[model samples]
Target: MTDTLETQPLDRAPATPEDLFAFLDAHGIRTTTVSHPPLFTVEDSKALRGELPGGHCKNLFLKDKKNRLWLVVALEDTAVDLKTLDRRIGSARLSFGRPELLWETLGVRPGAVTPFSVLNDREHLVTVVLERAMTAHELLNYHPLINDRTTAIRSADLLRFLRATGHEPEIVDLGPPSGS
Candidate 1:
């Protein structure tokens, strides 16, 4: 008898932004996707920053006791004290969103959280919080709805994605860097 061969079918659909460049292209949104080993933290994002093009961001999801969800996007190098951010965002206390909440709300993992995930926010329940300083930059980068890959996109195009996703973002001043 001939040897039998077994292959594993893809466990997950190639629906995430990383796997679907055509989605953005269809919308006339041009971007560059770069594959990195895997980065879980901003410091980690920083490590691979040189290899990637465009500015990077750190994303945070917070909730108020009332069950209100907030998405915070900030410059990767900026130091934000969540304790202080709590007041700015008008929340009880700012903390990382539970893994379940992340999946439920954005259909993403803890380390893979990105504003792009907002596409899955069907209810439009999450309010985006952006750093006012971001407007000064022409481009911003983040995971492509998946951490395995990073996408460098025009800041304007990102806004287009948010709008198409039905997300209204709030811009706030982050004051100054921790020591500054």
Candidate 2:
């Protein structure tokens, strides 16, 4: 049974940056990309944002106490109080996933993790978390799959891409409650 599944044409192919872009285009989701030096951290990509018009992102690959994995995509400037983040996402405590596991599950290096990596998650093991504030933005930017380039897409298109990949994201307000 496993062998038959592996040979099926419907099975997902190994994901690549080019494949990601093609997938985006095929869905009628337009995006613009720029090539630059590799950027692995939010701070590293700051300067490049000058030429890009969008909400730059800080993507986090996290794991919970029960080993459930999550990929959080939030505005780069959003304050992340990790201590309180699990409550917002319904996890029993969360910590950054190790680099090895990041590559193993998302098929990307630590610095290059993006929501797009979910394409490689054929097992659907990773749950995506999108910040509410980020959803308010018209445009958002993240690495396509590699850290050497950035791709800007409409925020709605992001949700579309995630759904298309069979990973419907959990949108949450990562910040403190409005009244609090």
Please give each candidate's TM-score.
Answer: 0.83, 0.88
State which candidate has the highest lDDT: 2
Task: For candidate 2, write residues 19-126 as lDDT tens digits.
Answer: 998899899999999889999788889965567887888999988877788898898888877799898899879989887777777888888989989988888888
Deviation in Å, model 2, residue 102 alpha carbon: 0.6
Residue pair clashes in candidate 1:
none
Which sections of candidate 1 miss by over 4 Å?
1-15, 18-20
Span of 10 residues, lowest total lDDT, candidate 1? 1-10
All models: lDDT?
0.74, 0.84
Q: For residue 65, what is the lDDT in candidate 1? A: 58
Encode model 1's per-residue lDDT on 1-180: one tens digit a residue.
Answer: 011101222234324674346667777888887777888988887876576656778898877655677899988766888778878867666667677776767777888888888877776778898887774578888888778788888888888878877887778887764466
RMSD in angstroms, all models?
9.4, 5.1
Question: Candidate 2: RMSD over Cα atoms?
Answer: 5.1
Error at 109, model 2, angstroms: 0.4
lDDT of 1: 0.74
